[model samples]
Target: MEADLEHYLEPGVGLLQDNASGCAWKNAAGKKISCAARETEALVSDLMVDQPLLWLLVSFSVGILLGKRLFRGN
Candidate 1:
């Protein structure tokens, strides 16, 4: 499924090779940090768990309002 999505999303771009294996951990300087994929997924899960629905709604509303104001010139 991921292969199909990648093909449609990046038509000109090359597909992700099946030879790919483990994930690389990059640091602030783009250096390998020795982090694992499981650790990254856990961190992302923790962040999503902490975020509130109201915050997302407010952010989306503000983005749309600002975009309209900027483009509509009023």
Candidate 2:
């Protein structure tokens, strides 16, 4: 019985060994765990939120530029 179980499990064992080096596992929701992009986005968002005037000016300028480009094709 034990030998039969080991034999049956050998393929799974080999697959796990082959994929052991990298991030081959998923979370409970089937998503690969990662934080670098999230961290950078959060940091930039926080900076934007903290600088209200700068954020507003930047957004206004971008909006104007986009509007002009769309309307005037320039």
Q: Identify the leading candidate in terms of lDDT.
A: 2
Candidate 1, 1-74: lDDT as tens digits: 87667756655344334424423442332432334666788877876788767568888999999999889954
Q: What is the C-alpha RMSD of each candidate to the true structure, in Å?
A: 16.0, 6.2
Off by over 4 Å in 1: 1-51
**How high is the CA lDDT of each candidate model?**
0.64, 0.73
TM-score of 1: 0.29
Report how far residue 71 has shifted in candidate 2, in Å.
2.0
Query: Each model's TM-score, in the order given?
Result: 0.29, 0.46
Candidate 2, run of 10 with poorest lDDT: 24-33
lDDT of 2 by residue, 1-74 (tens): 65666766756686766578554344432442356667788989998889889888999999999988889943
